[model samples]
Target: MIPDPTVRLIGWAVTRTAEAIVDRAADRIATKMKTCIVMTVRHRAVAALPKRGRV
Candidate 1:
């Protein structure tokens, strides 16, 4: 049986909204992970540098 036009439109809108929300959340997570990785790398590199003073 075919559903009402209004109901179908609402369902489609909800689906699209959910997808957009998910996409935004994933992007945020990826950005945070990237920042963490970069920070860790920088910290390790700094630690590896030779200390000043004392020959």
Candidate 2:
């Protein structure tokens, strides 16, 4: 099964990959959406601020 946009966009591949390997797809998606904001901020990816504002 393919991951959704949320998973890919978040780019937390290690966590996502572990989840996938464990068949935790929904958990992976939710974790991605949840963590993306924090990770982007940590990485200084301000582009997410605009996207978050739009959302």
Candidate 3:
């Protein structure tokens, strides 16, 4: 149990820490999603390009 005098500060610290963790996780997920989208587009573009000189 937290003491009354410091409880507010403690709660603030915990909340801030949780928010930071959530923010970092969100950033990582966004980066991975962006990378996946870019890769998919690249693959599609390459596949759509006209092939030449194949016997």
Candidate 4:
């Protein structure tokens, strides 16, 4: 399903914030582990794209 612009934007912010937290936590645990966390953020940002394209 596709989210509206507002919804998608909100989701984008939420997802980004969550990813940042996760990435920071990972860095705290192990500095070298940040690459995986960053990759995960990239994956999620891509996944959040509306399947039907933008409104």
By TM-score, the best candidate is 3
Encode model 1's per-residue lDDT on 1-55: one tens digit a residue: 6679989999999999999999999999999999999999999999999989977
Q: How accurate is candidate 2 locally (lDDT)?
A: 0.75
User: Candidate 1 overall Cα lDDT vs. reference?
Assistant: 0.97
Instruction: For candidate 2, give the lDDT of residue 20.
Output: 76
Residue clash pairs of candidate 1? none
Best by lDDT: 1
Candidate 3: deviation at residue 31, Å?
0.3
| Model 4 lDDT, full chain set | 0.88
lDDT of 3 by residue, 1-55 (tens): 7788699888999999999999999999999999999999999999999988878
Give RMSD to native, each candidate: 2.8, 18.9, 1.9, 23.9
Among residues 3 or more apart in sequence or in different chains, the pairs in candidate 4 whose N, CA or C atoms overlap within 3 Å are none
lDDT of each: 0.97, 0.75, 0.96, 0.88
Off by over 4 Å in 1: 1-3
Q: Write the per-residue lDDT of candidate 4 for residues 1-55, one digit (tens) a residue.
A: 5669988899999999999999998777785567778989999999999788578
Candidate 4 runs further than 4 Å off: 1-3, 31-55
